[model samples]
Target: MLNLNGQTHRRLAEAMQQAMLIPEGDELVFVIGRGNESSNLEALETWVKESLDVLEDDLALAVLPLLLNRLGQTINHWSPV
Candidate 1:
């Protein structure tokens, strides 16, 4: 994992929130293969968690697997930080 400062983390959170606005089943290409140890992954996870706060209780759990699957592809290909 990358060691991000607070500013980097905040930027990532913002980017992720934006990513979540994409339609379901439509790949968030910008986020999908951006690599696991970068700002993008930090943003992706932050946005997902924050967005889940505004959704119906169970929707996040349902969507998380799909999110993780796409993210996993990138993680599998990542080099350690």
Candidate 2:
């Protein structure tokens, strides 16, 4: 399981956001991330490439808790009983 705490998730997701703001075929040459946020993003990207399926919407997860909440709502609608 990807066990990221709320704060870490938000921070890393912000890193993901900043990276997204860069143009395609270009690299993120500058980033204003805390040390742990930088490390977390590096690790998360590596893990995603190595192990998981990363979606485009995952790049927009500035608030992971909200994503979780939305996912819960989705699940509640989809699951039967």
Candidate 3:
């Protein structure tokens, strides 16, 4: 199991970023500590949805495990820590 409380968040984010096949100009927002995990994840999801309004693939996420469930079955960029 992954802890959402401490350094795990940072590590998860970094791992995801390193594994992503991102293009230039895409942004990966770190919203982990800005709010509660659920809220922050929702906000990030909303941001992704809004961003998709213009360009669907303009963002990447470096997310912790709790939030990983929110991303569902499409993710292929994660690595175990």
The TM-score leader among the candidates is: 1
Candidate 2, superposed: residue stretches over 4 Å from native:
22-81
Clashes of 2: 0
Candidate 2 matches the true fold with a TM-score of: 0.26
31-69: candidate 2 lDDT, tens digit per residue: 333223235445444444334234534545656888899
TM-score of 1: 0.27
lDDT of 1 by residue, 2-37 (tens): 344567656665665566663333244355434433
What C-alpha lDDT do the candidate models reach, one value each?
0.56, 0.50, 0.41
Q: How many clashes would you count in candidate 1?
A: 1
Model 3 local distance difference test score = 0.41
Q: Which ten residues in a row have the lowest lDDT in candidate 1?
A: 22-31
Per-residue CA lDDT of model 3 for 1-81, tens digit only, reads 222343444454445444664322323334423343344334344443344445522323334554677565446446343
| List of clashing residue pairs for candidate 3 | none
> Residue-pair clashes per candidate, as listed?
1, 0, 0
Between candidates 1 and 3, name the one with more favorable TM-score: 1
Clashing pairs in 1: 12-43
> What would the C-alpha RMSD of candidate 3 be, to one decimal place?
14.7
Distance from true location, Cα of 51 in model 1, Å: 15
